[model samples]
Target chain A: MEKTQIEELVAKYNEGVADPKEIKWIEQLIESGEIDLTQLRELSGLDEQIQKMEVLSPSLNLDDRFYAALANEEKQIKKGTSFSMPSLSFLLPRLAMAAALILSGFGVGYFLQSPAQKSEVSELSQEVNDLKEMMMLSLLEKESATQRLKAVSLTSEMSQASEKVTNALFVALNQDDNVNVRLAALEALKPYVGKSSVRMKLIESIEAQYSPLVQIALAELMVSIHEKKSVNALRQLLENESMPKEVKTKISESIDVLI
Target chain B: MEALSDNALMMKVKEDDLGKMSLLFDRYKRPLYGFFYGLNKEQELSEDLVQNTFLRILKYRHLFHGEGDFRAWMFHIARNVNNDHHRKKRVKATEDLDNWQERIGHHENQSNEMQHNEEHNMLSMAMDRLPEDKREVLLLSKFEEKKYSEIGEVLGCTEGAVKVKVFRALQELKVIYKQLEKSH
Candidate 1:
């Protein structure tokens, strides 16, 4: 393709006038891998540095964690809770899924309107709830499996003894309302959190935060202590009347694992 | 295992398989994390976005019924969650000092020589020259390895639109590169 053709397509693209065929042409260039990518970065002036910086900049480990949250999110949906996606495409997929799901849902709803089907549906919902609880437990376990710091500091020393960094992370974790930030802080705190004495407050943060994820992380940390005292602590949290049932169940499950 | 695809792991999670969540987490945590890291210089913000992304997943787990490839679904989630975050913050991500330090330090480690360092430096400099929308399309498609469809999903444009944006982004980059070459 002539360079002008590519540029014209791009102009149309910026103007929202590009045709689909022209789009495909540009994609072919990108897929062919002939173009240098650094030039395409969103933030100008950083590509040269990011490339240079790429070596020291270790890859982020948020993908798995996002998957786990998504798993919990599914459960929340089953329990009649819903969150919207910000992507414009969300409306499209959601509308499509809603159509598909609601149609199937209506068919099933009508067929199941019979007494027996209703009973069966209720039974399925119960099983689903159990599954949700079970998933919650597993998610909690996964969150606890690591000291949050294991995410960044590959070496034990780096993960620990870096008071400056740890404190910075803690401040970020507790103050950052964005769950990802808190989770990252919790992960970053992993190295420092294992201290039997100083880390007891994590359980408090878990409670105060009111986020299931932090609760899971704290519950996981406590479960690994293997000390009878820690189990008692988890049992106390599990049995606390003020604690939400979901959290209580999570605490119980983690305790069960320890016991 | 490779045998347990993303759908399978999601199925397992649905079936009360807690370990499967870890299996899923093990697979994409870094890639997703890298996604945020690419957009923001604040390591702390990247972590926060990752957490919210996961929370969104938990809240939307029912949408993850065993049919679709979970990886794409997960990215769909990440993209949405991060966009929401970017909106709420209302802060345009300018270069951070820490990012600069890390970049220069990394170059020093890779090639203590002047030439390769210049190539890396010029490339970044040229990228910094593009407009945000073009740069964003380029970043999502090139660095994030998002499909045209996925890019559209994230940016709310069509796949065709993403292709055009990418093409223009590259052309723009070429212009910047030429400008950099001439300046020297």
Candidate 2:
């Protein structure tokens, strides 16, 4: 069709007198991009009104739900990306560099030491031990039973513990709230039990324990170490009216063995 | 600086900067809601479909290669969510006629309450009367700002095809609007 014919067809449609066949032709024109929706007057008015129609704004509940879901999605994405294994190609060079640095450090420390430097190194070692002792004491004071257990376990790493360290272990064995930490403290004190002061403290601690597990453990340790003086503390424990019968029987047997 | 484009924000979301989704949601929520509300005419359900569209966007963010318009991709998901809801509702509708009647009555009450202006009320009533496919095309034309090519992307057709769809929908709408005006 010529441009004039298409124009006349659109005019007739706009004037609302188009027959069914003419409307079909106009639909074909629209599909062919010959006539725009805007050129058809009545439909354009309706389209404009549809566009201008007011839509109610979504409530704050929608915002809350959307942001909540987005936050959950973000959390999942973070969890997915947080622990991806590094490719071997990316890790190999850094690993080689770190190994080389460690080897060089050992070589330098072994070769460069003299008498004065040895003394300085020994002093540095002493300062580190002091820091560890302070850290252990402070950690034993922590509220978390796991932290106090960690503090007691730190003593196993030391070749020689200071008096303050042993005192902290004694405090933990007698007064710590968690039985596991107290048990750990008892095990940690075992290595130092050869010292008379540590042995005396252990014997004293025998009377302070209320838990049957700790009481049985202390009684077993006393019998293992053959501490004859703990017989009095064991007898005192036997005198406690509230002590379980099994524990009193165990302590009585330990006292008889010591005698 | 100008705000990031929807495609830019979506690409960032694709790259695992998931917070960027909030920006896209803010930009499109109202228009998306309007599109759903135009078709469903229930405010809460429309809002829910809008949220489902964004949720799907986040879920499939990795698949968005940033080659196409973000709004078009969103409407594609919105159409699926709407269709899924209606599909499930259709099954339930067969099981319960009383519930369907109650819903119809509720929709009428909701439309009456929401349509404060008389002309807009008549137009909204006419829109509700339209068949789903025709109503969808008109709502897309309105909310998408008549970007026929992008609407075509959403509907899986050509720009010319989208224009024809808009024309047909509007022609029917005109007849319905005239009937509504006379009855009112």
Candidate 3:
């Protein structure tokens, strides 16, 4: 059909006088995009009214339900991404099997031990501690604060820490970028504070510390250990221009107590 | 910070930044609710369907490749949610229409605003008289703002087919509305 003929059909439909065949032709025209639904005056008016109709806004109850669902989903996501312990029912059998294996291994080792094997066992234990210390030191060098914290915590599992381990802890305490890791390093070093070398390093660490948290902790540690040598270092810290007044007061109080 | 585009937010949601889903929810909840409420005319059921639509969005978030329009993808899920609801209930669309006047009365009693507008009340009755498919097409047209192509994406049809659906729906609605006006 020509454009004028299609226009006539649309006009007929809009006038509400179109026969069925003309309405069918109008439908074809609408489908073909030659005529829009908006061209039909009555239908367009109805569509406009439908569009103008106002919907009631959902109540706060919907918000409550949606946010509750969202929060629940977020919890599920977190649980999926983070480590979570298995159910005790699921873990019981596995735990029993692991315990049996460890006990049998220990039994076999104990029965097989002679004086020569005993010395070799000591050597093996030393080598294991060495490996742990190496792993800890390497982890301490990691960029992640969590990894560094894990490294600091690893020292607590060692029955005897070598000088290398102590030196690594000192390095972490003095230079680690994370405050929590530094605090963990300080806690790890506390067990060895009775050593003259460790005490001197602890005193030395006081002046290098800038964080009031670490400075206060160190002052409290010095006061706890009765390390009077820390007074001069603490005094030097008080002299440092950038020291927080509270830390300076804390250090002064420690110095007076030590004197 | 600039607001992320819908696809960008959805992409983040797919990547497990699930918090971004809240942004998408806040944006679409009302429109989705309108679409569902337009279909069911029951406030609580419509709200439930809207919630179900979002839950499906989160569950199948991985399927959203961010290449298509987010709104279209959302309506696709919403259409399915509405269908699943009716399918599960086995409630006939005609039955809902049979109860349309009762539902309208209930709505009018619940909301004085609906009572104030006789034309919209008549239009709502006309919409309820439509078959589920026709009512759905009109609701999609209204909520989707006559973006027939996106409506097509939701309906799994072409743009022309969607336009024809809207045309037919409007034609029926006009007839029903006229009858309603004459009766009143």
TM-scores of all predicted structures: 0.38, 0.57, 0.57
Per-residue lDDT tens digits for candidate 2, residues A1-259, read 8899999998998888899999999989888988888899888888898889886688899999999998898888778778778999999999999999999999998898899999998899898888888899999989999999999999998868999899989999999889999899999999998999999999999878988889888988999999999988888888789888888888788888888
Judged by DockQ cut-offs, the docking class of candidate 1 is incorrect
Interface RMSD of each: 7.2, 1.1, 1.0
In the range B1-184, model 2's lDDT, one tens digit per residue, is 9989989999899898988888888888999998888777677888889989888888888899889998899999899999999999888888888787788887787767567533467878888889999999988988889899999999999999899889888888888888988987
Backbone clash count for every predicted candidate, in the order shown: 42, 0, 0
Using DockQ as the measure, which candidate wins?
2
Selected candidate, larger DockQ, 2 vs 3: 2
Q: What's the candidate order when arranged by decreasing DockQ? A: 2, 3, 1
Give the clash total for candidate 2.
Answer: 0
Candidate 1 chain A, run of 10 with poorest lDDT: A151-160
Would you list the clashing residue pairs of candidate 3?
Answer: none
